[model samples]
Target: MRVRHSTNLTRNGLTDWIVQRVSAVILAAYTLFIMAFFMCSVDVTYASWTGLFSNLWVKVFTLLTVFSIVAHAWIGMWTVFTDYVKSTAVRAFLQIGLFVILFFYFFTAVLAVWAV
Candidate 1:
């Protein structure tokens, strides 16, 4: 007999696995890029920091990094919640709370990166 697995979030095991890996790569690349940028800069001034993010490409990359972070967190948290939290009510509450917090963070990053 084949065991069927289902999730309310529409992501299957394969999709979730792929998403997690892709997001991880993006996160790693973004971190390295940021570190390199900081390392190469001689003067770490507020103006220089702001100037780096003022570029269109940098803003877009930052948004993508924010998205990758949220996606990675969601998948990891979802797996943990499903695996360890046995109570339906408790799991649902935690999942909802996690989503709310993640969404808020994503939106905040967007506003911060794009605001002139």
Candidate 2:
């Protein structure tokens, strides 16, 4: 029996597993990159910080990191809700709330990264 809903993210268990793992790797790589940036930049300043993000590659990478974060959070949270939330109405409410929040984060990141 397959549960279908417009709000459902991965839909298939295998797809969900793959997505979670890939997103985790992306998030980890992003974390390491940021850590290296901070470590190398001993004298960090507003201009230096902005300079890092101003690079085209870094800007694209930042957007990708933001996307991975949202995807990772959604899958993790949705699994938790399905496992622990017994009440149908409550689970739906929580899932829908999360769905909105994740999209909002993605859009906000896009705007922030691209905006001059």
**Cand. 1 Cα-lDDT:** 0.85
- Let me know the TM-score candidate 1 reaches against the reference structure: 0.91
How far in Å is the alpha carbon of 97 misplaced in model 1?
Answer: 0.5
- Among these predicted structures, which one has the highest TM-score? 1
lDDT of 2 by residue, 13-77 (tens): 78878988998898899899999989999898999999998999999989888988888888888
Q: CA lDDT of 75 in candidate 1?
A: 83
lDDT of 1 by residue, 6-104 (tens): 433344888888888998998999999999999999988999999898889999989998999998898898888888888878888998899999989
Score residue 107 of candidate 2 by CA lDDT.
94
Those runs of model 2 whose alpha carbons end farther than 4 Å from true positions after fitting are 1-6
Per-candidate Cα RMSD to the true structure, in Å, reads 2.6, 1.8
Q: lDDT of each structure? A: 0.85, 0.85
User: In model 2, which range of ten residues has the least summed lDDT?
Assistant: 1-10
